[model samples]
Target: MLAIRLDEPKQFRQIAIPEPERPGPGEALVRTHRMGVCGSDISGYLGHMPFFRYPRIPGHELGVEVLDVGPGVANVKAGDRCSIEPYMNCGTCYPCRKGNSNCCATLEVIGVMVDGGLRERFIVRADKLHPSEKLSFEQLALVETLAIGCHATDRGAPTDGDHALIIGAGPIGLATLEFTRLTGATITVMDMDQGRLDFCRETYGIERTVQFKGDGSELARLEEITGGDLYAVVTDATGNVKSMSNALNYVAPTGSLVYVGITTQEISLPHPLLHRREVSVKGSRNALPADFPRIIDLIERGVIDTDPWITHRTPIDKMIASFDSFTRRETGVIKAMIDVSGVS
Candidate 1:
């Protein structure tokens, strides 16, 4: 079997590995069909993600076809096409016991903590497979990325008529914007990248967008757009420490702020700002078990559009050569899909 591995920071190599063992009880042997390159994967490639390990098989966003299933696995059978929920949580953990397994104390996210589905075949717990008959492999591969936004919007809890501001127009930020639209709230997107802001305006029909200039003029523009009231819910997906810290400035007095991006640096919050606004602060981690099915259903029903999402594609054999360009901002890659099966 062929697999791509991150040998070290900024170094990717193609290697041959043994094919995966047959599925064990409660598991399924799946052939990787499609893989989505994520922002976290880029962070790992550049050695920016604190939790990322080197010499790792870096892919978690997957669409796969079941080759076989072990005894007692009923969720899927051979030939089923599915989207994988790659968070491998410890079911006995406190968070898992509380039905919040996305943040399990001993959570091991595939592709980050362990080898993932970058290879041709891998074994995943049967329960992690969300089978879909109506979706293509490309659409199925995007379920997990959209799930991050779904879960983050759940945390923000935006309501109808509320003004929601999403910072960053990257994949995660755009995902959050998609789910936030369902809340019936007026959305305003902010980003330093004009191309991304234009994408939101043209693709999503979003009229309100602020080009973030760290020069304080962007704040004035946001204030003017909101009539000085600011946003009811603010979600920051930039993962930049400075942006995360400044996000509180854009929230309305009684509104909430959600941090969808993770960083290793400690974020400092001004006491006066937090105390005066009485704001609710939250950190959204990975998606819940229920998110996968919900996202699949949405995609299947045509409620979530996957057409504009994938801007780039590369075959698995050429992925090693093309991976570096995906990291460059000049590439303008909204989503890059690795065609693992060669059929797509």
Candidate 2:
């Protein structure tokens, strides 16, 4: 079997690996079709990802087809196309016991902690697969990423007529924008790049946008948008410490602030400001089991669009040559898809 591995930072080599054995009692052998490169993968390539290991197969956003299944596999069978939930959670942990499996104590995110599906074939637990007859392989591959945004919005619990402000217009931010729009909230987005903000307004129908500058004027612009009340919910998808810290200034009094992006550095907050506002602060991690299927259903029902989100593609043979280009800021790579099945 052919596999792409990150042997070290800034290096990727295609090598022959032993084909996976037949699925075990509760697993399935899946053929990889579409695999999306995520920000974490870029971080891993640059040695910026925390707790990430080298010599890893770097793919978790997957759309796959079942090749065969071991005994007791019932939700899907051969020829069924499905989305892979790559976050493997241990069911016996404290969070898992409370039905919060997404944050299980010993969570393993494939491509980050273990071998992932960036190969000709990969084996996965059958329970983590969610099949959708209506979604294409590309759309199916996108389910996991979209689910992240869905879970973030759900954490804030926005209602119809609520006003929400999302910072960052990258893929994750766009996903957050979509689900937030579905909540009937008048959506406004902020980003440093004019291109991204324009895409949000033109492609996603976002009602308002503010180009972020470190200057205090961006806050005033947001305040103007909300008639001085600011936003009822503020979600930061910037994955940047400075921006996350700045995002605190935009939260409305008595509103919620959900940090969807992760950063390893210690973050400081304005004490008296958040204290006086009575802000509800929360962190959103990986998505739950229910989120994947719900997102698939929404895409299937035409409630969300994935086709336009994919702006770049590469055959597996060319991935190494082209991967770095996608990371360049000027390249404007929105979503880069690797055609695993097309590898020679």
Candidate 3:
């Protein structure tokens, strides 16, 4: 089996490893067809993710074909195409017991904490596969990315006619925007990159966008858009500590602020501002198990468009050579997909 591993920061090597054993009980052996490179993968590649281990096979967002299923695996059978929920949660954890397994205490995200499905084939728990008959491999690979936004909007609980602001125009932020739009909220997107903001406006039909200038003019612009009232739901997908900290300023009184992006640095929130607004602060981790099926259904029904999401792709043979370009801002890579099945 051919695989690409991150030997160290900014270094990837192609290697041949033994093929995985047959699926064990409650698991399924699946051939990887497509894999999406997430921001976390870029962070890991740049040595920015503290939890990321070197010499890792990095891939979590996967579209796969079930090759074989072990005993008791009823969710999917051979030849079924599916999207994988890569958060390997320990069912016994406190959060898992509470039905919040996305943030389970001992959660091991595929590709980050463990070797992931960057190779031709891998074994995943049968329960983690969300089978879809109507989606293509690329769309199936996108389920996990969309699920992140799906879960974030759920956390913020935006409603129809409410004002929601997504602070970031990256893939995660765009995902959040998709779900927030479904809520019937008047959504506004803020980003430093004009190119991304333009894409959101042209592609998503979003009319309200504030381009950050770092001069504090955006605050006035947001206030003007909201008629002096800030947004009812504000989701920050920047994963930058500065942006996360400043997100509180955009939330309306009694509104919710959801941090969909993770930051290693400590985020300082003003106690006075928090007390004044009585804002509800939330940390949205990985998507819930249910999110996969929901996103799949939405995409299947044409509710959420996946056409404009993928901006770059590379076959397995060229992925190592192309990976660096995906991280460069100049390339404008929104969602980069890897064709894992193309490996000879």
Clashes of each: 0, 0, 0
Q: In angstroms, how far off is 115's CA in candidate 2? A: 0.7
lDDT of 1 by residue, 1-344 (tens): 88889988899888899978889999999999999999989999988898898889989999999999999999899999999999999899899999999999988999998999888898899999999988999999999999999999999999999999999999999999999999999999999989999999999999999999899998899999999999999999999999999999999998999999988888988879988999999999989989999999999899999999999999998888999899887789999999999732
lDDT of 3 by residue, 111-208 (tens): 99999989998899999999999999999999999999999999999999999999998989999999999999999999999999999989999999
lDDT of 2 at 334: 87
lDDT of each candidate versus the true structure? 0.93, 0.90, 0.93
Worst 10 residues of 3 by lDDT: 46-55
| Per-model TM-score versus the true fold | 0.98, 0.98, 0.98
Q: Which pairs clash (backbone N, Cα, C closer than 3 Å) in model 1? A: none
What is the TM-score (0 to 1) of candidate 1? 0.98
Model 2 regions lying over 4 Å from their true place: none
Candidate 3 residue pairs in backbone clash: none
Off by over 4 Å in 3: none
Worst 10 residues of 1 by lDDT: 335-344
